[model samples]
Target: MSHEYYRRGKNWFTAIGLLFCVMGGIVLIQQLLIWGIDFVEDFLFNAEFTNEKVSVAMLCFGIFMIALGFRKHEEKR
Candidate 1:
């Protein structure tokens, strides 16, 4: 079989790993109330997460996890 076909199992594992990555990255988003980063109230109501710091943090975390997901997929290749 081709390398692509041979790598199917690895790709499955990578996808599973990516799920964990996304979960971990969004932990902050989940823990918003405890950390005072709740987006709904802070963003829409109080303009809380609308600030640069929170936005940047969220962006960095999201991008990092997404990059990690790609890296995980690549390793299987």
Candidate 2:
């Protein structure tokens, strides 16, 4: 029973992570095209929450979640 719960949780994590990754990727690409790489540097150095920053955050978080889900799945084996 608990194993089933874990499996579902892992699936959810992976699914949500993928969604975030896609959304972030789309936004990041759009921002990059509009503002170029210089904007990325600005966002990194500046203490502001811009679309690029949010997208990067989302991308990082998504990757972390995906790794967590996969790690859990492997541990179950």
Query: What TM-score, over all chains together, does every model reach?
Result: 0.32, 0.71
Which predicted model would earn the best lDDT? 2
As a whole number from 0 to 100, the lDDT of residue 32 in candidate 2 is: 78
The lDDT of each candidate is 0.51, 0.80
Q: Which stretches of candidate 2 lie over 4 Å from their true place?
A: 1-10, 73-77
Q: Cα RMSD for candidate 2?
A: 5.3
Best by TM-score: 2
TM-score, model 2 to reference: 0.71
lDDT per residue, candidate 1, 8-39, as tens digits? 34444346555655664565455564556554
Which residue ranges in model 1 land beyond 4 Å of their true spot?
5-50, 72-77
